[model samples]
Target: MTLTTPEAPAGLPAPTTPGRGRGRSRRAGRADTRLPRARARRPLLFWPVTAAVTAFVLAFVAPFLVIVTNAFKTSADYRNNGPLSWPEEWNWDILADVWERVGFTQKLVNSVQISLGVVLIAVVLALFNAYALGIGRVRWRNAFLVFFLAVNVLPQEGMVYPVYYVFREVGLYDTKLGYTLLIGVVYSAFGTYLLTSVFAGFPRELLEAAALDGASRWTTLWRIVLPMSWPTLSVMCVFFFVWSWNEFLMPLVLLISGENQTVPLGLSVLQGQYSSDPTAMSAAALLGVVPMIAFFLVFQRTLTRGISAGAVK
Candidate 1:
């Protein structure tokens, strides 16, 4: 009887070598170690991203700070100090003066009334139009949709003169009602297109089911369509409201009198008419932004919700 041991081949380690197992163990350890280092490097790359966001935020907030500080100073103080510096004295006198001079209280009420009217009209028209184009049996719907989108591409100034002439011919100029109507007309096309897209994304089966349950078209729309489309409607309403409130150019040409003018138009007059007083102009500008800020604070949650819903399936 004989016993035999296997021979080691060339370019191969001997089976009895003491260091072979340790070498293999070390190789495995190195492979395992490389992964965590790669993972650790991921977070290190985020610093530039965070820095850019911080810079963007500062760029936006700085102008607001300058406006607020300038509003609290005397015209002389503004001349003496830098735009970013603190006011020597907390002078609210400019605010009072601007309010009285510009008739801010009356203008605020006018702006609110006009903007509300615009929102109501714009939302109603846009919803009906969207429903017709998106859900109802309509001929040339795609062509009309393209038309509406094309309307958004043109500058508003292109139509300003024609609109002004039409208003004048109809004797609707210089009235709050006229301004509201104009706002609705200008905003409807874009609104209709946006809302129609939203409507198209909704499940048609829900509407059909309601119809099978003996619901009328209008009933189904109010109950099923409108309810599910709340997020889109909310976003549109907020957008229209803010834009109408802040609209300056159209109102300036259309509403000639200070009494009928919106807040933005009145603020422009304040800036121009008080060119000698920087403090007063700054105070008026600050006052003008207060309503917008208040609105954002109140509806910011709805805004975020709407955006999230619109983006997700």
Candidate 2:
């Protein structure tokens, strides 16, 4: 009696025991209904996503394509046809002509000078300011941060009058030197705000360890923090460079001399009041964007790595 297995009631016909086949059939039936719904639901999601991505891609790429196609086209071809149509013959002379007419070499040099100057000044200022606010945890740091945010909030339009007046007074109104300093300081506001957040999240244990080793704060910063944050700083530098490079309104207002003008200002030569050269304009546009695009492509991997490495830290 103690060893006896439990038995079902006879009248219940042994509880109508089902074999693996019956259970398998039930599961298969459930899967049949579920799988079809899942399969049907997939296309519903996939198609919309594909369509949206395609729309966005075309929206962005279509203009670039137009620029590139028109860049190599002859004036007659561009005028006879349109921007979207392929060029009948590739007139490579447009680039050389546009280059010489606009003094592109000088303009590009000006752009590089301004961009590099801005990057160095802005990144350094941002790093130091971020360190003080984020790592040092200075008094009223939040207030200081708010001030930086406020600076960024003021649109260029609002500051233009005052800036123009001040620069005029200083006799820097039409100089590359003035533009570099002005744009660098202006761009640093955002960089300070961005780097502050990154610095605030820096590992405390590392700081403590450095202190234990008798490394001064300044020493620790360069020797340790700087390297750790190099990826982030590199990313920020790229942003500042691109921002200052593409600066239009400020350059337009300040740089009156053709020799002093940055790359963006050179685009003016492509257009005229009475008539504009569409092909030449396209060529200039193509040339203008090439450097920045190349810069971004080079740093794209660093940005991705910085973000991923940051998550772990």
Candidate 3:
């Protein structure tokens, strides 16, 4: 052991000179250098995006805050208090008054029935129309699409009188079926446009493959096209539902009887008849907002995905 002359401490190689080790380290560090300054600064790009997002959220949330706050307010509070002010306490009686005055349950049921009917008719017709426009070799395709686009651009005011006259002539005036049909026809053009784009983007190979396997056109559409197009369909349904539910002008023109009035019309009636009750009006408006909010919440993901897909491809 003593003669082991420090036999370079068992398995260890002789250590390099300090300068040499440092030189090697410097070279290795250079070789393993990270990305350039511009590349490294890429993460800073999100700053503007973050700012934009912050601004957007504030803008949208501000009005919603006002609506929700006013719903809890007394008439005096709404008139005298600041919009930004928070509620001092919960107010239950205001909601109760609104519910009774507006016949909230009956109006809500009518709205549901009308909106559901519109959606059913519009979506069914839209599905067929979209398939024809997108996949079928129907004549005057561009003209047809352009016609719908033109319809969308027209002021609703212009259609109202014409529609009123037509419904009057057909003895369909003051009927739920009339309003349903009117809203469906007016709104269906846009739905067809949306669905057409989605259907057009579908890979033709899937359709062809199904055809080769002896699948009829209807069968293929039922099994493949509709299933794959759910995101777009959901977006359309939610959109149409919101539109139909919120429609005030059409319902006003079409529905005359107390038994047939939709929620929006009924809310308007309450507002006029109960001008003395600010609490009631605010409450009725708040109640009216619930269905639209629920519709968005339920289908928001599908709407987002459908929009994203549409944008990308």
Candidate 4:
């Protein structure tokens, strides 16, 4: 006899296979979830970071704008209107008057000479010092590095007397070469500390290859290390230049002659023992700041490349 099959209830449909429909359903669910997540990520992190950076830019730029506007204003207008107001007239004469009175051309030359000298000497000294301590693996180098760091922490104020006495006794007093050498060597302590850490992390493979090729330490340093580390060296030069250019107390103490006074020292003359000129002082500030701005603009590409190169390798 033939057997008969069971049938579904009248209103119900048949059940589906487990793997086939379930896999397609899971994929559809994933696609739906990802659409919402991608939409969520579209606004995340970017807007907040952009807003913070914009605020910082404005904070720095606003002061410079105020300075420029005030630099263009006449004494009468500035006195009447206040620092925040726009200039009534753009007076180039104020700048010329300040320039002549300050002997800014002479001061500019002094600053350039001192700053460049400091950078050159400091970079060479730091480079050699770090090479020995870091790559050479000199005896007790860690101890030496620690000592250098401790020296850096010593306040410049405390060392003033000893340095002044030495300079006087050495007959380097009131000369450009005197303080240029002094500041350069003093600043090299920090550079040595910084470069030691960098050199310590240098690739041992490259160093070993140089050694295997019978390259002397000096040859290796000049041919391989120096060229590779040029970015870092450039950064160090920039720092040293800026530091020397802005040096005030040291120059004031060491450079007694009026002709030898740097930008900062010369600008201080405007304060005077008896009287002050506000418009001229503003103009002086503009003159002092312009060189630094120009220097930064010229080196901006170098700085960006240096930082990125450092980050990458």
Candidate closest to the true structure, highest TM-score:
4
Model 4 lDDT per residue over 193-244, tens place: 9889889998999999999999999999999889988898888888889989
Comparison by lDDT, 1 against 2, better one: 2
Instruction: Determine which window of 10 residues in candidate 2 has minimal summed lDDT.
Output: 12-21
Expressed as tens digits, the lDDT of each residue in 1-313 for candidate 2 is 3765458877764443448669988999998989988888999999999999999999999999999999999988988898889989999888999999999999999999989999998998888899999899999999999999999999999888899999999999999899899988888889889889998988999999999999998998899899998888877887788889888999999898999999988898778899898888989999998998898789889878776776776
**TM-score of each model, paired residue for residue:** 0.86, 0.85, 0.82, 0.87
How many clashes show up in model 4? 0
What ranking emerges by TM-score with the best candidate at the front? 4, 1, 2, 3
The clash count for each model shown is: 0, 0, 0, 0
Instruction: Give the alpha carbon lDDT tens digit for every residue of 7-97 in model 3.
Output: 4677889666569899999898876675566576876897888999999999997777677777787666666775567767668788887
The alpha-carbon lDDT assigned to residue 174 of candidate 2 equals: 92
Runs in model 4 with CA error above 4 Å? 1-33
What overall lDDT, based on C-alpha atoms, would model 2 receive against the true structure?
A: 0.89
Ranking by lDDT: 2, 4, 1, 3
**Model 4: colliding residue pairs:** none
Error of 3 at 46 (Å): 4.9
Model 1 misplaced regions, further than 4 Å:
1-39
Global lDDT of each candidate: 0.87, 0.89, 0.82, 0.89
